[model samples]
Target: MTFPEKVDYVIVGAGIHGLSTAWHFAVKLKARGKCDGSKIVVIDKDSIAAGASGIACGVVRNNYYQPAMRELMTLCVDVWESDAKNLHYHNVGYMQISPKCMEEDVAEIFAQQ
Candidate 1:
């Protein structure tokens, strides 16, 4: 594999989080006038965003039952919609589908987060 002469950061995973982190790092470097696609490289054992990000349904929502997760998920959604626009992102509008009953067990999901 060919590598860069110099690299600023190396993220292992090509999942959404890794890609987002790399994007933000590049954005910050650009904002500081330190970079414009310079010396920043993201390498995945596989293809970029070919893991979870590719298989995901790309749903954005804040209606989660947990507070912390809800906030993080909300931030993820915002970045996907707003920040992605600079790179030409089209928002298809996220939909949150709830179960027929609101009394289902959602505590585990929140707890894991």
Candidate 2:
């Protein structure tokens, strides 16, 4: 593979955050009549999602207590559910076992869900 001698943008990682940032930035720049994404380059020591994003330990749930967080989670859930194939989103059910002190908050979260 060959890379250009000079590029407008250089992204260090190909992980989720890096790709998302580069994509959104490029979109905004193009919308404003700025540079196209051709000059942008994404480089990673390893392959894409070679970091924590490649791990399977993370969990996304709508179990937050705050209103804003809950709303954000709702949007995230929608996005995840919408693209199950490419995103590899597993809809495995979640189970939460908390102590007595968290019973109220847990119940509230359940109600919200």
Candidate 3:
């Protein structure tokens, strides 16, 4: 296949993060009446979620020490909850084991969560 000589966007990978970035970026561009999403190209080595995202233990966690990261994870959980049934989500709860040095950080994360 012939690749575009020039495009508005050329995103790498097609995993969750990559796809989400492309979607949000294209939306912003169109919102400003800059150009159509046709200029956007997403090239993956295998396929969508064909990387690590495709084969995980399915253990989704939002436990984060940083507030910003926690918020982002919360948004992810929200998306998962939005389509719980079809997604077959299970709120099995969360647990973590860290060294004593990280005890304080873990406590902060728990409180925020």
Candidate 4:
């Protein structure tokens, strides 16, 4: 189809991040009666999910060396949990199998969270 001359939102990619952001925006706009599919446009050089997100194995984990990363991951997990069915997410939980040497470090990270 030919592209429209104007759009309310123009998403640059169709990868996980872009798609999720677009979905959230569309949801909010619809609630405000400000948008429908016609008002939003997602432009991607490749097919949806054909970028790094598609090649990378899907693994949701809260493990991170930085507190900020952990917090962000926690928030992401919450979003996934909120719409597990719609998002096709399996909240079966994650396991971090570590060697005895890293047990203390892992424990410390867990404690911080």
Highest TM-score scorer = 3
Cα lDDT tens digits for candidate 1, 37-104: 55667778889778878887655555567678777876776767677857555656444455757535
What is candidate 4's lDDT per residue for 25-82, written digit by digit as tens? Answer: 9998888888775788899998988899889877778778789999999898898889
Q: Which stretches of candidate 3 lie over 4 Å from their true place?
A: 1-6
- Per-model TM-score versus the true fold: 0.60, 0.74, 0.75, 0.71
lDDT of each: 0.70, 0.87, 0.87, 0.86
Q: Which stretches of candidate 4 lie over 4 Å from their true place?
A: 82-105
Report the lDDT tens digits of candidate 2 across residue range 1-113: 59789998899998888998889888998998988887788999999999987885767877878989989988988988899789888888688999999999999888877
For candidate 1, what is the TM-score? Answer: 0.60
Residue pairs with backbone atoms closer than 3 Å in model 3 (clashes): none
Model 1 clash pairs?
none
The weakest ten consecutive residues by lDDT in model 3 span: 57-66
Residue 6 in candidate 1 has what lDDT?
A: 76
Residue ranges of candidate 1 with Cα displaced over 4 Å: 76-113
Give the TM-score (vs. native) of candidate 3.
0.75
- For each candidate, how many residue pairs have backbone atoms clashing (under 3 Å)? 0, 0, 0, 0
Q: What is the C-alpha RMSD of each candidate to the true structure, in Å?
A: 5.8, 2.6, 2.5, 3.0
- Say what the RMSD of model 2 is: 2.6
